[model samples]
Target chain A: MANDTLQPALPTPESPASSVSTPQAGWVPMVLIGIALTFLALILYIPAINVFYQAFHKGIGPFLHNLQEPNFQRAVWMTLTLAAIAVPVNTIFGLCTAWSLANKHFRGRTLLLSIIDLPFAISPVVAGLMIMLLYGRQGWFGNWLLDRDIRIVFGLPAMVLATAFVSMPFVAREVIPVLEEEGTDQEQAAYTLGATPWQTFWRVTVPNIRWGLLYGILLTNARAMGEFGAVAVVSGNIIGKTQSLPLFVEEAYRNYDTEAACSAAVLLALLAIVTLILKEILERRTGGHLRKRH
Target chain B: MTATDHLPRTGTAPWQVFWHSLIHLPWTWRVMLGYLTLMLLLPTAALFTKSLSIGPAEFWRIATSPIALSAYDVTFTTSLIAALIDGVFGVLIAWVLVRYQFPFQKIIDASIDLPFALPTAVAGLTLATVYSENGWIGALLAPFGIKVAFTRLGVGVAMMFISLPFVVRTVQPVLMQMERETEEAAWSLGASSWLTFWRVLLPPLLPAILTGVALGFSRAVGEFGSTVIISSNTPFKDLIAPVLVFQRLEQYDYAGATVIGTVMLLISLLMLLVINFIQAWGRRYG
Candidate 1:
């Protein structure tokens, strides 16, 4: 089962008449690659390198000085806390959701699938607004919340909710396709062998999907940490209190605190870099089969 | 009587069967669906309700007002342009990554997702700096009397930054899995390389390309973080709908914000539906 080759949903028909051809060892392909790389450098690579250069251009003195500031520290702490609370909850939820969707054949399943992806398609600002409509002072449950003296909107909880909403599909999206392809043969065999559902899931299913699950968690953590728009509306951007790192970057940049903004941005970029590295490591270790599934 | 008793049930009541099935469902389904309903379903439902509450006339008025209309025009047009640019360049990059071997090729392949991994605010800040007149690339282009940052072009660039990975990632796998045998066959038949590509290679690739375009379009349309910083956000000039929605929320204009948010939401939903349809069609026919 572990060695089984799962066919992707869209099967490419092989034409027996012809063998696939490789590019000629000549100048044309080289020129094409060069041109493509130039565009990529302009659009993606240069801007990224510029970020690191600018952040450190003033030397480590100001960079270290900015990192030591209270607001910066608070923002980093807030961002980490948000990811801490959000990632685990969503990871567990994603696992359950993927398992159910992959194993069951109920009606409206496609709708459920689309709903999971709704966050990705929806604007983050709108995501914040939806929560406000439900939990804001004049929201649907506003009066009850006020009566209970509970705060959601303009608070940590609200920011976490928005972040969770934005990053919801990551884990499930990663795991679902793999689970679908893996099928239930081993699972059924486990059941026949008198293994309990939980046992089968732990011993059989989890092992198969762990790599995809880890990839999803990494992505979810990154997005949750970096989310700005949704959390911006919901968090009120109260410095030293509610501001996440991304919000700090925006506020700092708008206030013309380029040093602080760039410093904070560099931290986030490092996080992103770390994510990329880990992703690459995972891809290499897993033979990168899961990478293509997406 | 014996036959009747032994025969399988053919006409069970629908609701009764549904109830039985619901009861029989595992705890996993209940937990998953229940959680999704609370966290996702409820919030989305609230937006729909609030949007509808504004009365059709008011919703239409706000949705199509000149400012709203201009924001819509800027948002959709720039997103489309960005998506198209990404479509062409993205395919090129994917082709290179799959078809070539060069120094730092591994690094370049991995770095394609830098935009995805970076915080949008950071990306925005970085791109803004890089494209500003006094900045690196912008300094070179400044002599040409062309400005990138603080213009509609800047908005497009930001959108391009955020959406490029979508195009590349979607198309890369298909390209990797492509059977080169057919192109070889065409060549053996005395067909030119370009002709072989134009006819054989492109037909199968078109659907994936369109899928990538649609996905990139949706992402670019909804983009706000990078765009807000890079573009000047002047009304009817570079102000995008998402930023406008943020501006409204800041002004305590909940109703107005909800209306605009609803508009963005509906349009995005339509796009997503279209994408899903295209993907389904590709699956069936591609």
Candidate 2:
């Protein structure tokens, strides 16, 4: 609220003294900032340090041995397998949606764009519920699928579906803008040169949007691996079976295996760090290109 | 040139006609239609059908149950409080990142995105560990009569953490795009910093800031992963709507879960609509 009061004066530049005299420089603001930042630091640093410290307590031997546990290995594999399946599926879906939106005109274009952005607005936990409502035995489609003897929820398929549903928007959101900005000139040029649609897409369009697509896929991978709410609801947290890395950490923490939980968390954190680094690199490169053009 | 001059006057093949007609469809239209039909329409329809098929009486009974009502209160109030907190700091952080040259700028910038990168469950677990009674920060705060972990405050804190990046990232680009000359002009005119910021700079940034707030609020409302881990799923205390939905599903209360979920979805949709309206109004008048 104090900040809201200060917002109106944002355009003005005053002497340092006068500026400090404003409401934002009051003791209240200082105290608030201190509390906030202190809380932030506590929230960020403690568990992070705890995990790494726990990991390194007996050096790499025990830590490495922790990774050899059947549950840990299964979690790692499941996380990767989910990402592997979901990312590609979502990427293809995103690409097709982007390509369709980019290249054709029919009806309800704006409506469709909003729909493409839907998953971003919806809660992941709710998304999992939707999947269950549709695919669970009591679901509308669930009965139909059951007749075919197909089990979706409470298994790997459910995990994949939930991840893919939430991750679908990433690649499309990234690629659509690039395609919109770049226009269809390159594709048209390729078309005029006697290239087929597939060739033009691969040779011309993909090259132009590869960075965006990769960035999108990278984001998707990070989310898929880190995804908890949707997966947890559907995966049933069946130990090594449906347990993702995040779920493994949660289960371990719940089961009072503090050391194992922290170690698993550290593994997830490491993956997060790597993705963050990659995202930074890609963002910087994209920003540089945009700057050059401007 | 006449149409006849541009093209050979020959009968077109059926396949050629079909392909040309398909290709000639407006790109945006085709993709948009398909996307909406498949992604948005189908899933939402499924959800709604589930919600509505139980009829109004059953829906009301399920939705107004004590547990459901409590979850709603917790979800909305916490989300609102968290969003308000994050909005202020999010703007400050964005401004600092964009305008100030400071030590550890890159680190601070990256740190702002930690919530976005970290898994919500991990974030929740981390927060719980750090704020528990025997935890590092908890050890210090415990003497002060402030218990964080497994409280409403913990829910708010976890929600704030997970939703932080939305507001900051949303506001950052807008802040960066603002021309510096406006501030300089206000200063040259002898306006006080507060006056200039209030009269000139604040109006334009208001829309983006509000958008950020709405996004943060929505995210906090729907946040389940971190909140569940940190808050201990205590109903009527720290229980959020999404967690309630999960609990309902686990208990095989499909209709009840759907009713609660639909309420949340509707509320979020309303908020988003309001935000969009505010953004449009701001663009037109602010």
Candidate 3:
């Protein structure tokens, strides 16, 4: 009723702006857009372009050469392996957490959600420090691990754990709302029709939240592969062994290997872009919960 | 519903409540809790315990050491400046994106999250290169004697870069939800654009902008990858606290690292609470 008292201009999906904000002074919109564009061009677009420009500045031969370096290839493999290990773990955690959240209400549910979101708030450096505290040679489990000859705090185990710590919340954050929206009516119907819980979940619920799951997994994988600070603290940055791509970029740039650094940066930049584009598509496709701050 | 749902709740003892919830718990809940305990809770507990093991005096002395003090000053001051800049320009950008039609608007809108989706290490490398003394933007500022890269100013640039999207994303939703008629009414009553914005728009926008600034400030303060790369890492000059923590760790000062790390984490956690409060206020007032 109060809405009817207002202008009847309904916002369309294509141009929500124009409807809510009626025609302004022509210069107003133009100048606003121009200033925004100019700001983005300087801060965002220029940096993006400079990465590509510097990567190719020395010509494609050197660029290709940099990409072919043993350490560079090794870094790429490390990142993929890290993502493969971390994303699935977080995905399972997210799915189970979301399932528990949607299927029942429990005491301390809100507190649990807050705990899941802890990594998002904590500094990555601090997060790494936490892992070191728990697993470092001088740490709580240090002696036990020493006796067993298991190494952490500077190895693949530590790297995977750090990546997992940093990227764990994405899948849960993405899925919870989607699960809430999809509801349980279909699952209940399937159960009523003699389908087992697993069958109903696999056949009914999984399809319902596939887009959300994909979005979550996409974000988780990107974060897992690109993680830097925490992994840097724990990975020991041993070239060809522990350095992920992001760490490799920093090391290369610091060593004055501009071509190598930028080439590797180009790959990570592409991952970032791919993450962005796929994010856009998923967001549009599902009208997703990405808009909300998780 | 589980069996517990049908149970009478009046005057139930706490232990009984716990036992009821425990025995009837679904497999998913059990798995989820176990994972979280191993992954999130234990690490967090370890951090606090290790930091506290040295006692409060030691924690204080290490946390407030001269270098640590200077690092916090640099981190908070630069982050504040960056967040303030974000608040101003973020409002303008969100306004334009949600209030005006333009070519590539959707793309531009999505670009705001590039800082977020893009890895900070990548962002750090790019910002350092592009703002170096010989680079494009740095060259433009060179004549003004304004150095950006490898300085404290570069730290601010990085903070602003990474936290750029917070204010815009926060404000965009509120701006999109606004009624156009209110602005028209203000304008028809002889208010100028600035006057209307000051009187009508800024009121509702204040909470969101504050929330955004708080969020960005927390993010900037806790930032590691980019600021560590961009700044000179001088103890009293450009070095931020997270970098300082990393420095201490490299020197085998795990205790020093933990103390400083605890301080940084606590500051961010405080900021998180403040942001949530502002968001709650926004919901209430809006």
Interface RMSD of every predicted model, in angstroms: 7.5, 7.1, 6.1
Tell me the tens digit of each residue's lDDT in model 3 across B91-136. 9999987776666878988888888888888888889988998988
Output the lDDT of residue B282, model 1. Answer: 81
Identify the CAPRI category of the predicted complex in candidate 1.
acceptable
Q: Please give the range of 10 consecutive residues that has the lowest summed lDDT in model 1 chain B.
A: B1-10
**Colliding pairs, model 3:** none
lDDT of 3: 0.87
Q: B1-286, model 1: which lDDT tens digit per residue?
A: 3312433366878676666666766787787777788788898889889888889999899988899999999999999999999999999888878876777988888898988889999999988999999989999999999899999999999999999988899889888888866865666655555778789888888878899999889998988889999999999899999999999989989888999999999899899889888888888875
Q: How high is the CA lDDT of each candidate model?
A: 0.87, 0.79, 0.87
Candidate rank order under TM-score:
3, 1, 2
Q: What are the models' TM-scores?
A: 0.92, 0.87, 0.93
Each candidate's fnat: 0.66, 0.35, 0.63
Better candidate by DockQ, 1 or 2: 1
Of the pair 1 and 2, which is ahead by TM-score? 1
The digit string of per-residue lDDT tens for model 2 on B209-234 reads: 88888888988888888899889788
Model 1: chain B TM-score vs. truth?
0.92
Write down the lDDT that model 2 would get. 0.79
Candidate that beats the other on TM-score, 2 or 3, i.e. the better one: 3
